[model samples]
Target chain A: MEKADHLSMKDEPEVQGEPTKTAVHLSTKDRPKVPGEPTKTGTSMVDTAAAAVQSFAPLNQIHQHLCAFHFYAYDMTRQVEAHHFCSHINEDMRQCLIYDGPDPNARLIGLEYMVTEKLFMTLPDDEKKLWHTHEWEVKGGFLFMPGVPEVMQRQDLEKVAKTYGKVFHFWQVELGHELPIGLPNLMMAVTRDGQLYPEMIKETEKQFGISIEKERESRAYMKGPEHGIHPLANGGGKGLKLELREVDIKPVESVPRVFV
Target chain B: MASSGDEDQVPPGDPVTVSTLVIDAGTKIMQRRLPVKQMNTHVSTFAIYGGDMSRQIETHHYIHRVNDEFLQCAVFASDHSDAPLIGIEYVISDRLYENLPQDEQKLWHSHAYEVKSGSWAYPRLPEVVASPELKNIAKTYGKFWCTWQIDRGDKLPMGAPELMMSPQGVGQGVLRPELVKRRDEKYNISTDELKQRRAEIAEPEWINPMADYWKQHGKCFVLDIVTVEMNRNEKFP
Candidate 1:
């Protein structure tokens, strides 16, 4: 694969003497007449050099390594709905684009981020409270990597099952609001079975044409010890121990403002 | 006035107590007439952009909540009560960050590392208040661009907006000692000591890939016309 070739070639000394593309806009006639003088045109030598650096093949490898996955998420606070298309920046982090629906014209709702368990554990206890673990989401078959081979999907779930996600919903579209309004509400993943309404899951299953039971069966081997905890017991399973402390400050008048 | 050479120490005393008035419903309560609503005030420091990177400026962030979507923080350089307003930083949830256009998204920086590593802190606020605030801030992203390069000795804000980024994976030597010394004297806190305290804050194995964009691409000054103009004006060629 071209990606594999790029990775393998990373350690090798860069091959020199490659033909460099010159800016066609700057002809020989436009070159500085004097040896040490500046070019007459508005474009400086720095601009030319910057354009060269941008076209370098090595830098593009970083962009090429990105991978995408699909997931269904519900707001932890309210019964608001969301679907996510996450792009993995690396093995450690993924940035997801949340959409109201799976359709092309779906309103972009918010963003979610997933990080490895190692990274999640490094967060401060309070910050840790904001994140929801993926154990139940993966094992219960709520999260899926759509359009991949079953085996590959299983492998992806195995890795994802060990990660934690931080999500926020800007637009409360479920409330029939066309625009994003209010302070961004912190959204958490439904880590337990009963945490999410059964009807929502059924609706999602119907829309995706997949059975959650079958998904769970396919990913059964990926289940770890963490999933053994009963969802209803112990504050909704192993990793869902987040409790937001109440702020005692009085609510003041709402500030009038305009968002750029 | 505290100088860079001063060895300032934080006074050993109890935490200051704040008192609030209790008003009974039968008593008349006085209220001030205001045209607009008030915003929560937050204080922090930012290492300024300029010569040798030796300047740290105190900033007061007046945060205006725009519903549940985002907060717009008007950042002012708080050298005095009536300090000069430097810039505005719009903070949005990661959800909003994702909805932003690809090019627009590149401008925002994640605060997870900043808060967790203790690089960004609230010096005045109690730990209890600050910790939860940081926890909420951790989930969001900020787009901060300063028009003024005060540390560089710019009397007024000039040129295009220069993006402000959080310091990450930066060592003690990377910071200008004189600036740190001055800021330490003013705040009665040591950057070296803070760095030592935060030494155990392990960096996450996975960081947002774009977080390092400035570090990687910032060295290429040839792309910026302002740099070229400055270099030409200074006869650096």
Candidate 2:
């Protein structure tokens, strides 16, 4: 909520010129570049920056934070690797991180939580099949179901860790521990349209015992993985100047309770 | 005011001899007499081109004929665009000038004809040929080709004849007496009907059928070169 407030303040006067917008672009591009860069013309510079940063890290990293903090998507591992890997590296970063096929387990993990019938139907076949099976009869016919328990399933956690990395990353300045101004609300607001409004964020936070905040007293520069938010330092590459502060927002708030 | 040693100084005749006269396409323009002063703003100037004398006379007479029929008809207003006048220049010997009709010859010196406005519309030439209106104009004037102005903001009517006419900036003209007479004789329509028909016929989609027909045959319709040259001279299509 505080983050959204700060962002509105920041964005209000930002429309005066292209400098702040350009800042976002340059910030995202603070990475090594790769060969055969796609041309950027007429496209908003912000998209280019986000794309550049996505290339620096694995899609699993982005996916992990996104799922942990917001809605869950099944079969995200293959999709992330296939569609997102090594796509946004600046030319210099391309020299450093070649798009070689490396073991993804070292950097990521996948989660396999129980989903509702509605949620199961919402997912594709490959994703829905990742759970257990059950059978029951409804009005017109007998229904065969992939039975997933209501509680935070063990296999789901394992899957999450396997696909997205074990340590999810968020950003903090060199020694500071608080979540930066807009990032936390930004994380809460990431599902689709814009940021979640203040009321929704509060309601969701109260319903889920999880805390996305980092402890002020902690001396560690990186937020510990147990905190469910990883902190990583970004920036410092050619053609990029400002350092980026990022946090991985994961999807842990909506696990169903298993009665068994 | 001749100097003391200027006994042999003779007045220079027309700069170029009529027999050897040569004027490139950009030098002359034809303007229909209208209250054009209303259109010019501080930045906007009517484009004027050097045109042949007789064509200029016809254009001017055409304006007078229209004004006499439809007193106070607002036709070519300059207020819509910022482009300056642009067209060609021609040097006609007195012999050619005398051959023109008495009424047209009288129009040569009246407000019915406006001299070149010294305005340049664009840096490059127009690529499209003479306008359909001009082709029809040529038909009325008994000539194969002549210049005409498309009213400001109005495009040329499609299916215009192949006549040597340069596309000028947007221009509109009141209905001339001959045109009104012809309309009454041919279709029994009024000036209002003509205006409505003109608007309906100038849609951009009107050219699609021609384009599609050409595409079906795996061939393309190319504009005439003379029209292209006229556009090049007028800096308009």
Candidate 3:
């Protein structure tokens, strides 16, 4: 099958091109009228994000790449109601993979993550077996950011572990020659009980030492009869295509001794 | 096939009867669009923003402030990439559009969009002011979070005050009986002429498109407001 033509335009990010020689600073006063022009925080940021996507793209394309490399693999079995698992799937963050095809022949069509008041429980024997598993066998595909770095003087990682019970790892994926700043290794955690995957920012702060300013969350919705297709295909095309809603959060300056 | 009222549903280009009475009403508008350092939605969808065609499109609730009769009127959905979405268009009374601050103009470009197809266009208005009852309806139910579609009993004319009063009008106007007399008697201005001036002063490019469903049903006019809680992301108060 010929791949969709529009796919290239959608997938090819502007950052993929060779770095522009001209620098573009975007201070509030000097910012251009253009709404979403790329920032000139130097090439490192661009190169890193591009590299992350490049690495992720291929790995994601091959479902068993990790398994072929000896990583333990499991097909997302049937989707029962949201249940708590000690692994990546949990009550607060229940996710199931929807395959476009029923078997290996089909690609992953969509992923649904749900968080609600209902909580899922786990069995003690199952928890023990999962805990004994080695690091080499476990592999996950996701985007991560470090919460605190390992070298930070405050030992923020320890604080995070104490505040939000933790069980996960962190890594900085190098994209070719460039060491991206914001696109550094992700700080992530997989729960023994599938729940809110606590972002591992504490480890990031340890390495980068309090560089990030804030945390924000956003929701995206596609308007259509075809569900996911662009609106224009449905006849009600508009210049503005995407709708994103956002949430604001204040950052913690330093970890408190205790939660009030 | 059901009620006599149901039999008179609207068909495109077909003249439909509108009763003076207000029928079913609802609102569907988004609140203000805050300025964020990162416009991720724009980037993800348009692959363009802050560029030459980088126009800011802020959404807000449509309010009616006439008597204590605030209400929601209609709901709109269109794909503007084809042409501007069309709800019954109305010209706002110049007096009302002019009252809006320039900063607001900079913020809420007031254009409508059809979700299915990505298109953008300016709405044409017949007049600025709605009836005192309509204004009251908007004010009472006009929340920053919702949009509304309405049906009054009358066919919307293609002109000003009459068009605004047409089931789908969203323009503001002077409801005081005395002001109406003064503007008309002293200035010899018909409601249409006043609306012409109103459109000039306000220069509003934004208008809501009534959903095609409402248009077909022969709604007198449509009003749309978007309520905040309706947003799926609104998990907390």
Candidate 4:
């Protein structure tokens, strides 16, 4: 996990004056030209034609937008801002599309799914380690529903404060890799005070014209989990990082087919 | 600010909350964006761990084909409107799979059997368009992860995402017959008929041996969180 210190914050430029919280776009340099000449006319024409014929009902149901920050599970200091366009799979669960930013050039870097506490406590010890409690992120003022006000956001925040998320980040944007070049890495959320860089929080507050202090105060009355945070979760400050290892697929007696 | 119990204690099943009051008072979300409409194709299939076919999962994939060679999908537990989000999968052509480093190749599984066995189906799309697409997809390989192990009845997605493999070949250790029957009945289709219907899709000239390495080698890749270095002070230092 100490490999996390290798990530330098300078890779991602600061969030500037965003007129709206939903303006989660990043300020980055222009793209370098590719060898082939670009042709937008043909692309747009196909998109228009396809739209005239195709059905997009499932995608249409995705409506909620939540923007937050995720750090490489191994490194507490390295962080990336992610915008989640989510839809309810069920009342107990939510699936989201995690993008690095909201710009046209932005990359869809990861996928995160959330579940409430009643379901969370059912996980085994080892399994719990893979999930992070959202209490700190919600109660700590680091997570928000972008354009929604606190009053409207609270109903969901109350539910979220007791939930957990498992994030799989396909792109290592924090490493400054222009392309998604590596296998996915598990990502985590900040669970305690002092872990988030002071300046980073200050920049977001200034850009959005919102105060983290006031956000915490507004959510003060919201209840914390009665069971408390799991000790094995969030790497338990062990500086966790996801890595791949080869293992034998366990041999099992196959269940014979009961029907044709 | 809405005061706590300073007002009457809210009754059971109360329709009015501060949120409803705020909404009733004309608060609105002035600006918002949702860019996920790219997903269009929906296919339902089954997947099993590369190591164990005894444990199987029913998957609902809402896909967006990026180009002739690539596609990404969001996976859910079922086709039921209320199904829980389960995981994600990315499918790539043989050309891309071959170019990947040897170690990376071991992580992916071929879709040939899934297509040929009639296990993978586009339930809603017309067979005319779906047939051509299925033929092209049969030659590709996919790598997926299951976050919520609903098959185990965990109620929530737990643990790190479990890397999944598509069942290749036929019989016993491969896709189970009962599971196939269940899927067939749900969609009002016959696996045996699909097996015959898709029989004409020509098998690719070659599938990388490294792909689906476990079936032959008995080994699979797993996600781990081995502490690379101690963040705290070490005795050696």
Among the numbered candidates, top TM-score falls to 4
Show pairs that collide, candidate 1. Answer: A110-B95, A111-B95, A182-B67, A182-B68, A182-B69, A183-B67, A183-B68, A183-B69, A184-B68, A184-B69
Task: Return whichever of 1 and 4 wins on DockQ.
Answer: 4
- Which has the greatest lDDT? 4
DockQ of 1: 0.02
Cα shift from native, residue A202, model 4 (Å): 6.8
lDDT of 4 by residue, B102-185 (tens): 776777889988898888887745455567677778988997876666666454555556778887774324766777767777
- As a whole number from 0 to 100, the lDDT of residue A203 in candidate 3 is 26
- What DockQ do the predictions score, one after another? 0.02, 0.00, 0.01, 0.21
Note the chain A TM-score of all models in turn.
0.58, 0.18, 0.16, 0.78
Single out the weakest 10-residue window by summed lDDT for candidate 4 chain B: B1-10
Off by over 4 Å in 3: A1-141, A146-260, B1-213, B216-237
For residues A12-41, what per-residue lDDT tens digits would candidate 4 score against the true structure?
343221111111212223221111223245
Using DockQ as the measure, which candidate wins? 4
TM-score of each: 0.36, 0.15, 0.18, 0.75
lDDT of 3 by residue, B134-156 (tens): 22112111111111111221211
Ordered by DockQ, highest first, the candidates read: 4, 1, 3, 2
Please estimate how well model 4 matches the true structure, expressed as its whole-model Cα lDDT: 0.64
Candidate 3 lDDT by residue in tens digits, A1-260: 22221122222233322222221111111111211113234322332333333222111111111000000001011111110111112112222222211222122111221122111111122111111111111112111112212133122111112111111110011111111111101011222222111122222223333332221111011111112211211011111111122112112222122222
lDDT of 1 at A57: 20
lDDT of 1 at A253: 25
Candidate order by TM-score, decreasing, is 4, 1, 3, 2
Cα shift from native, residue A218, model 4 (Å) = 4.6
